[model samples]
Target: MHLGKKKAFIFIAIACVCAGVFFALKTSNNTVKISYDPNDGSSKTTTKTVYSKQGQTVQDLLKNNGYSVDKDLYYYSTSLADQASKIHNVRIVKKANGVITIGDKKIRYSSVQKTISDLLDEKNIKINKDDIVTPGTSTLLTSKIKNINVVRVTKAQVASSEDIPYQTEVVADSNVTQGSSKVEQSGQNGQKTVVSEAVYHNGVLVSEKVKSTSVKTEPVKMKVSLNPSDIAANTSSRGSTSSISSVDSSNASSTSSSQASTSTDSAGKSTAATIGDNTSKSKGVAEIKDDSKSATVKDTTQKSETSTKAPDSSNTSNNQAASSASESSNNASMTETSKKSDENSNTSEKSDSSTITKTSTVNIPFKTCNVYVSNLAKGTTQITTQGVNGEKTVTTEMTYKDGNLVSQKEISSTITKQPVTQVVAVGTKEEQTTTQSTDSNQSGTTATSASTSSSSASAPSSSSGNTQSSLSQYVSQTKNVTYNHKTENISASDFDFLCAVVSQEDNSGYEGALAVISCIMNRADSGKWGGSTAVSVVKAEGQFSAYGDGNYTKYLNGKSSAAVQAAVKDCVYGGVRNHSYYSFQAKAKTTKSVKIGGNYYQ
Candidate 1:
């Protein structure tokens, strides 16, 4: 029993010693090192050592050591063990509130990430290689950063096909009728494929560039055949199908045929059918030929009968009488010949003289219209639309008798083309001038204001040389100046509205803003689109978006920039000029165009 009690006492002593060692280790203090880095741009860092119990957790250690952690701030440690000794270093970082814009989404987030790359990763935002990020990925994020922008960029090649219109060509053909035309060849349109590189910003197309264009088929030109007479009329009014020389030639041919037929029957029969072909051919040629032939036959027959029945000396008187009759017949034949010759000449002359219908063109003068403009300087004029002379067709009947003009009467007159009116812009703006001169070469006036009369005082003829020298000196000393005019029709409110429209449409620089103002001014001046005045044009239905949606009010009342205001003054006061452009749009519809800012003008 004594030996068992001694062993038990030794075991109890060992247990108490082990228990004391374990409690002492658990209660012992440890030094934990902590380092904090503020992700701010200052790059500041601080280190601290804290006393902690071995069994205490990281949170318990910090709390026991009087360290406070903000809820918005995220804390981290190199080691996250429950035991204080395991955590040698602890870091505390600050988070920031930021708004991120990517694609079409705007997200508000609070994160402890120090860089843009880390923030995007934390938000699970995927980025492609071709995408663009503003405030680059390496940019540090801080509390001061309020917004971030990311552009989703994509590249692609697109192919499209279009048909090219065929051209029509006209050709003169003699085989066709005098006033007729026919199609010689059919026209065919060509096809071409265009390859373009399209660029998109956030799924919206920003630009497209043509990479290549290949022809799939060639175009064919249409050919048309027109008669010479039709071509002559179409080409010019002076040209004629049947000229005066041709008319004269036809008349001469008919006259020669008439003379030949009166002498013999050889040419008469051959040409009798073609006589009607000449418009001036007479019927006297055939009639005279018949009479001459019959008379000749009768005379020959009578002479033969007399020769066969010869009389004796008692019929000598009959012989004398026969001789006298023969002489009478000869004289009669001579008279007939002379008369025929005269008739032939007269008939030829009558054939040459015929009524001709001619058509000629006359010019009709165009009217001039003066449009008063306030923007241009006084006494200045600009031609907007050129004057064009119109044409009219006058049909006249000319009667010619004995190769002489008898009379000409107009049959009809019709206008072929309408005259284009001349449009001139006249300046009405008054200018301040120092003096007015009579010299035609001088333009504008001096900048200074004066009350000198335009006409100089009459000089004495005795001192003409001195007066001329003095006048030359006076002209040399004067300065020339120009003033811009204003439209008396446009009200103050309308002018402000016009400037506001320009500002809202374009944010580009001076020239870019000027392009917009010019387009509006051109539309107002043209008077073909909707209205003739500036305000009327703006208020026209379905024309401008700025006025329709009332967005132009944003830039009203001097809220626009200096560039926009200057552009307005330049356009309204004639400081800048635009003559061709009358229309503009966001997208270009024609190949030939001018691009300014984000709009296209043509």
Candidate 2:
């Protein structure tokens, strides 16, 4: 028994030695080399060869070795949780191959392309040296990146010629008759050459800056004379008129203070001449008095007469005879003077008694209209049609006393040009909202917040789905109608007409209704089809199927659903929009057409 025990011990020792050798071989075979690189601009790398046990992963190896890595860094060769079986070389680096947009194109570049510059070379997207690139050419491509914009910048010096319009100048001239005027100088358009640097983005003109401008031809100013009649024709009842007339040198010194005249009598005293019924004596009183001081002046009826004082009653008979001869000569001279004065008085009465009437033009202000647009940003406005003032003809009668303004009144006014309405497009496009939830195990607070955000987002999504369902159900029950109704932009009547059209044409709910309204709004903003208003666009002939067929009129008479009414109002006033189409048919017939609801919009 002792001999048997010795032999068994030796055999067991050898078997144990063989089992240890096999275990060492298996351990060495499962060993892996791990290299930790911070890769943060510093060339520091740590390499380690660890004996991996069965079922042990790379993540566990890192934990046991106390090697803490960045959260963004990961195993370059394989997954961290994967078994480290026969791993030759393991590295830590940031992951790549995320989606990124370059201009309008999207690409998910491979990790092999390292940088944006390298990716562009691989994709064969050539960019000019002056072209702008977002981020940087040396920037590394990774999952954190979202977009890459490449702006193609091209510049050119362009010379273009433009015509300069001439300006008109009006000059008031009394020599130009009341109704007659002449253009002193005729106007001619001039030319100018402008040198500018034009910038283009992706073959589309973006900006142009003028470097210099040279006048090819100088513009001429138009000189015109003002007509005096225009002032009288445009007279208002509250305004006055002043007559302007050219007078001869003989009457230039005459004053219009009064009609009576003063004279020195034979007694060396001043006498005031009074006007009478005698036409000959009444004309030019000063001249008649100077002609003969001793002669007796008589009225037309011979009932009144005036004679200068007898030249000093103490004079001798010879003196009296000489005085008598002088009186006869003076009387003859007075008679001739009276005839001349009578002729002048008749001419003055003819001019003073007549009234002149004139006709002129005035401007009328245009009305402004507000239109909603879905594509434009809120609070922004664009003028689609310019406001033009209208013209109207006004006639007035003016009366003047002497050579001064007396009174004026408006006679009549008629519209010559109709005022054009101003159309302004008000932006109503709402900003889109996006919900993002990110989870992280490193912080409990972050994870909790992410969960809360995710739940909050779900509520809105569910409510939106329910609302959509309700709209769909309401539209399906309604039918199209054909009738006409007049409406204005943003007015109560406009709201009614919009609702009727939406309910009649669309059976797809809010989306369909919005599409119809958008089309109408687009047409109205363009002012091309029918008119520049929502009401006019909808009621246009052959524009909508429901109008003029009696069905639309019936719908208008009845009440529209609350949902349909809300959609119409929101689109017209609140700025809700879906499609910016002007016309629609049963199906899409062109490449520019888009299908919405039951029709194609273009």
Candidate 3:
């Protein structure tokens, strides 16, 4: 009984010690309740109870457990160890990772960066100010931002050359033959150096800007001369007239002489004349010299006896009357001859014989005759003989009726000097072609002795058979040339604008006008005052002085001369005379600017 009682006491004491140790362990350890919701949106909560010492952190507890805490996730209590004495509830949220693409490179990152800029900084990627970013640097880095694109932008200057073609100008020439043309000046291409700034995005060209342009060489205009059809026809007519004159020389001379003789005879025989004296019983014939030349008179009358028987008072009166009548008739005859001679001397034509009774000396003009010849150059004149004035003495016969002169006549004419014929040679040689041949040995070597014969012949002469044709009114010379510069194509409106500006600004000459055009083009290429286009540069406000008062507008609407157009073309295609010059004005006293055309430029 004593041994049984001792064993029971020892068991009760050991059980009491084990119960105290369990109570101490339950009070010392802490319980952490972790709650999390899956991203699947299910209304279910996951609870995790972690038992640890009061000093253990949430991060430590999560790491110790199989649950990993994402860096991008949120935890309700980050410092659980400090709050362990007060609370034990811990909440955590899962965050998604995002992809960023930067200039063909892709990267995966968490949302911890908060912003794109921060993300880039963390990745150590640099971007230029001009670079393009799909997601702005200030944008928040969230799961919604799945893609981030970065484009590298760059600028570069590119240079190249383009050719400018020359223009053609036509001029009318009457001297050139019809249906033909001549090139006075040949056309040449011009050169232009173009500088452009190119914009590149991600190593690909996106856009280009014109930086500057310069003309290396100017184009040379082509000049062509054309003849009118009418001029050619006129020249042919002149040739034919010259030929006819040569063939009809002799006939013309003979006809001229016959006309002169016939005219003289008709004048002399204009009227009939007779000479008479005062005595009734006797008729007297008198001869007079006329101014035309020599003259003679003939009278048909029988000699009659004078009255011898005397009467008383009646007879005395009759005798007195007869004596008075005879005296009056003689006086009248002499007066009439004098008047006729005066008229003949003043005028080469014969006077009325019935009214003229006297003659006088006179001078006559000599005639000119032409003789044509062939086989000589046209417009050639040879004076075979010289003409001199002739003097002539004229005689006339007169008749009196009732004591008054009634008729008169001229008998002959004498020439002191004769007229001469003029001789002229005309060209009849038509333009012809001849060919000749020459023999030459290709090698400088002697051949073996051999019999050789040669013969000479003369060509037969042939006439041109009076065939005539006109010659060209003008002569044309042609030339061809290659340009040293290149050229570029331009719109018609732009070209017209250039032409108008040049015409108004520099009407001095082609060279001066071209200088003005060059200045404007230079300004356009400079990219300073105005736009790069020609029209923009020219129309720039306050740039061209002509545009100040709307004059430039007027000029643009007006017609431009061919010369100005040609000059503008040359300048547009070619480079400026001095590429450095950008301003020009009318010539003045100042010497700061260089002179070109009539204007000064700097």
Each prediction's Cα lDDT score? Answer: 0.54, 0.51, 0.48
Candidate 1 pairs with clashing backbones: 374-485, 374-486, 375-485
For candidate 3, write residues 37-156 as lDDT tens digits. 443334466888878665666677767766666655543445644544334777765543667675567887655455788888888879899988877899766545667888889887
Better of 1 and 3 by TM-score: 1
After superposition, which runs of candidate 2 have C-alpha atoms over 4 Å from their true positions?
Answer: 1-30, 35-49, 53-88, 112-114, 156-159, 169-174, 178-180, 226-522, 525-602
Q: Model 3, which residues run further than 4 Å from truth?
A: 1-96, 175-180, 227-602
Top TM-score prediction, candidate number: 2
**lDDT (Cα, tens digit) per residue for candidate 2, span 484-564:** 122223544555567777766663445566678778877887888887888787788867776655355544522443345
Summed backbone clashes in each candidate are 3, 8, 36
Using TM-score, rank the candidates from best to worst. Answer: 2, 1, 3
Candidate 2: 10-residue stretch with minimal lDDT: 270-279
| Candidate 1 lDDT tens digits, 1-602 | 99999999999999999999987775676678877666676778788898777577877776776666564565465434468866667776656777899877999978777788999999999888988888888888876677889999987786755455455455678885543345565555577887879777786556678999999999876555545544333223322121111122235321111111111111112110100110123332111121332221111111111122233423324322222223333222111111112231223221234454555665545544344445434333334445566665544444455566544444444556755544344434444324433334465544444463232211112324212101111122222212232332344455567868887677454555667776776777788768876677778997777787788997664445444554555455432433357777655556886776556777
lDDT of 2 at 348: 23
Q: Who wins the lDDT comparison?
A: 1
